[model samples]
Target chain A: MGITDETLKRRLDGFRKRMRDKEIDMALLVEPDNQYYVSGFRAISYSRPIICLVYLNSLQFILPELEKDHASQSARTDELYVYHEIACHRGKDTQFHRPLEHLLDRQPASSTIGVEVDTLPAALYCMLHERNFIVKDMGPDLMEMRMKKDQEEIHWIKQAGVLSDLALESSLHHVQPGISELELDSFGDKKLLEAASQQFPDQLIGFADWTCSGITRSFMPHLASSTRKLEKNDVVVHSRQVWVNHYRAENERTFLIGRPSNEQKYCLELAIEAQAQAMQVVKPGVCAKDIDLAAYHVFEKHGYGEHVQHRTGHGLGLTEHEEPYLRFDNELQLEEGMVYTIEPGIYVPGVGGFRHSDTVIVTNNGFESVTQYPRSLEDMIL
Target chain B: MGITDETLKRRLDGFRKRMRDKEIDMALLVEPDNQYYVSGFRAISYSRPIICLVYLNSLQFILPELEKDHASQSARTDELYVYHEIACHRGKDTQFHRPLEHLLDRQPASSTIGVEVDTLPAALYCMLHERNFIVKDMGPDLMEMRMKKDQEEIHWIKQAGVLSDLALESSLHHVQPGISELELDSFGDKKLLEAASQQFPDQLIGFADWTCSGITRSFMPHLASSTRKLEKNDVVVHSRQVWVNHYRAENERTFLIGRPSNEQKYCLELAIEAQAQAMQVVKPGVCAKDIDLAAYHVFEKHGYGEHVQHRTGHGLGLTEHEEPYLRFDNELQLEEGMVYTIEPGIYVPGVGGFRHSDTVIVTNNGFESVTQYPRSLEDMIL
Candidate 1:
């Protein structure tokens, strides 16, 4: 969807201010997510090298001619320049490298060009260097801009959360005796497709244990479902969610297939308490590490500190995993309009682990949990 | 699986000979497919930063430590060197910037290092260049070697093909009206997961023609199902086949949700015939373009030339889309042991498109269609 002209202006203005403060002359946005963030356009043809050169006064988009129409309609074009692909026969198309040359010809030399150096291909970088563009680090600055979610972004994420909740409900039905872990993933995946308001790229599916046991937790974001069948007291942890290009919503809950033992119940309670503790203190101005510490302290008080593995949470948006992670070392302060996860878990080697995770948007005073799936200890049952 | 010690030595010797002939001292393999070809390991971390440096006598596998074990298990120890997470991690054992420095420390100054410059990240390239390693283009030479599959690679591809055929067959029964496209994908995906010999990433599941009238041909190669309700004459096209790492055994066929018109029948017939004609000429000592021409001419003769879009086929193995493509421009010679697709399609913009793609391996004499799913027009009934 095209961003409103005012919104585009606002974003560009924001970036301009940040660039001026950092003394970066021009930011060359290459990463798809960053491009989408500043211009509100996702490239239709990514095969041919394409990028947006965003300057304070001028915005230029370079793309193959086949994709020019899509780019023009999607990107706010009143302030942008377009590159069209020539109608060349298939063989001749390989030698077509004039667009980049044309862009360089029009621009000034010796101007410091900020690039998403981390993602730009070596060939493209070489080509740019050959033309004498002074490439500098623009990745971190661009990341900072996208770290905060605006109202519209949060709205979409909340919508995505609703779909995730429905998908979890549908998938839970398939977890019966004899069902393989892989089958549960497929079942959950199918439910996601059925539940989504609309399909997104990558057919994104994140499947993990509902409860970590033995060597299962090592995989972290394991794509394969568990091989072990659900037993009477088997606890499983899983995250069911999707991201439509960066705007993401996920909900994770640990479940017991049947009856649970006292230890399992205790583990689940600790995890819930840990998550609750993070949630209680989640608000604008709080250091992200404080949330991790809050959750860590709760687990430690219960003599399960070592088992509180991983960060309390991580910022979630455009990508399923992003910056401002709620880890012990992170110094990012929680801000209004910031959305991230509050996932805290406890794992015991031979036994199992419990985790409660939800996407939460830091609000003016507190936080709004986007994931509405049932997380109460009473509701989590076979 | 570790390559047989003999096979590893033989491949290494072959690479050395090729490098010498090309006047290159060393070629760096970073593309996962190329890395898997040289070393028998395929990484589950598809987009993660990992680079494998292969020299005349030794191979250095540099990656995030989480992947060291996977890479080591895939390649031989005699030729392996590893750089782990310690060098890369910056804080909380999470953020990392060290392994990259470690990689640069090992690079020999003034040595000719061949890199797949097209895929290498710009930042990494700059870092390597700053360390004084001269980088050169190695993709063309490596791609030439991979155009033809070896005996063992062909064997695994055929095995993957058989499993894919079964997956398609079992999933056909689940296609019906009122079923969401995601449900169809899930059913087929479940079968694939159950029958998986090895995990393949981004296996094709072209359901509706999402490109044109949103029916068959448009949603191709790597599309997941959506919540779109299946209906009469939807012309569902699913190639939810498994890819065994770089080796793929993909089989795609269109289905008539209900009764299909004569136009639809002709489209499917023309596509199947085109694929047949292309298959007839498949063998060693032929150029890839000839195979493409065979199919192109047939469709042209049938007055459906304009309808046939995209390349006639593409090489398979290592990457789902590989070199030696069956396109008008491809002049690469077909050799025995080369494996690729011979898919020919006919797309009518507003109605639907039809394609019949099969994994074909160039035999010593002719060719063998690895995907043996029934392709008779009569067998395509819903």
Candidate 2:
């Protein structure tokens, strides 16, 4: 149903090996996704601060009292230190830092502590620094470990892809002039939930979507779905990410409403071709930059290179956007089991944005796209 | 419409005044909500580092190239330093830190900087520390400013509350034993989006929901809505947060399905009474703890105090949970225009969880409940 104990053990072992290599006595994980990767427990939000400390031989969780029971049932930890928020347990540990400090006291004064530098809050980092603990960044190590997908992770990602395809299909089916961007997104959301409920009972499923409709809105890369009604000749960039059991698969498409200009149709086809070119470059032993360049050349050859705003794609799994990004500057070699989104987008001020993203896993020789939604210009025009 | 330019100007002035009082020459905000509060712009995600710098005279934004157009349109910043990910802009700023370092280089070497210590990443903190800048926490100041909603904020929140009530009604109308928790949530989600699309044209509307059905699942709060089917005699805690233009209003309810036990009915009534007691204490000049204790007393009087795990309520706004928490240890006085969620619950092991949450804005004398979903036991029993 969730991450298996064996999987957690393997992850811990890999993390421990990296910790040893870095001479880190302990690793403090504050990132929710990183913590979930190691402890197999994730809270809805970290507004109260949930800290997962991974010692060489043991795992510890310092969490809010509300999550005490939930973490106990799910977390693969050796010790749990619950912090109370209510009045009844006022005298006891009421803040996460209290338990964290207590745990830090047990360690030798000179012990080097590892943390996800990019995610750990400055306040907590200062606490360790004040104690004279040698702090080191373990962010890259964790990202490297999580970059490659295991069989179990791939399985959930596949399920998410299937659900995302269903959602995209539903959204497209209901797309019409005068329907608001949010209303268009709602149709897919409803269908996805219904289908997921029927097929994957008892599994935790979540999704996020962004639909930027109209020339002005779609020209910008990121925006939430608003109540802006779709109009004739409007361009809409709809993106959806669905996750099953915490593994994510991103699926996005750019479509045109009635009477789209020839330029708009051409841009949509270019985006589709760019995505295909990027996906075709996905194979074991290929450089990540090669994938980005492959897609860039397509747009460059078409005289739309100056319009490209972002990188080709980003790694996908537990987080919305992880490391091993398919960027021109990233020289990381592609490997089997690594999953990425092959989305190459270009935004022209008057024409609008064009992009189609699909989640694909690098296979033994090439890549297997989990998201099989249609991407042709004919399929996209509504 | 978005935040008014005058409102952003006033917010900046207030923030600058706080900075002056604290002797902070410059303030760096990393938390998206805080950044948005000051700059009137927020990205979808911070996977790419988006730093907002606030000085006494001017505001600056350091963001990715992709967000340049988006920020230019939405942000009230005087300066923007765009960092590129693609190779074409390689000679220019290739990473966020490059621009960040350049910006810092312009600051006085011995200047003190205010930062949201709880939200700023350790990596950025270390960068500042290495350059010998004195860092101070401005998280409390930001929280204090955000705790009290302005008239414009209240307007959006009220709209969110109205939409939430409509969504809740739709979900309850479709509630059935055979429906999965995710399916239940979808009904509300669909209704909310559809209604929002019609009512608030071109405005950004978003929502999140958690449906914990059955005794075991309901007993533990904070779990996401899953593909678990509802059953007869089930206790379901359905929680929702709907936001309009980023101002949120939470509306939640605990309902009984098909013939709940007598104990379950009593617990639901007790929870409703506790919530009422807490709401009654929400007035200007009252301590925050008073609101919590008022609710705590109800459960304590019933000899079910031990069943309470979380605080009675939390401040509601852009973030899921913010400051001025209604906890026994928090003695901060409630002020007019402050918003809080009056959610008091008792999670009985076998009887299930009973809780109802409603967002309320503090008024001159008492409070105005924005979320007016029915809370009567008779209304809850299905």
For all candidates in order, the CA lDDT equals 0.67, 0.93
Residues A273-321 of candidate 2: C-alpha lDDT, one tens digit per residue: 9998888878899999999999999999999999999999999899989
- The TM-scores that each candidate's chain B achieves against the reference are 0.86, 0.99
lDDT of 1 at A223: 28
Local error of candidate 2 at B336, Å? 0.7
Q: List the lowest-lDDT window of 10 residues for candidate 1 chain B.
A: B204-213
lDDT of 2 by residue, B210-304 (tens): 99999989999789999999998899999988999999999999999989999999999999999999998888999999999999999999999
> Interface root mean square deviation for model 1, in Å?
6.9
lDDT of 1 by residue, A1-382 (tens): 3356777788889888877776767777777778877887765332445678888787777654434445656676444343321112343333225655666666687766777887777877776688787777778877787788877787678767776777677767676655545555566666666665245432322222232322344233322243444455567776676654336887887877677777778888888988998899888898988888888888888888756545677787876667777877677888998888988877665557688789999889998888888887777766
- Look at candidate 1 and tell me the lDDT of residue B90: 30
For candidate 2, the per-residue lDDT at A241 reads: 88
User: What is the Å distance of residue A176 in model 2 from its true position?
Assistant: 0.6
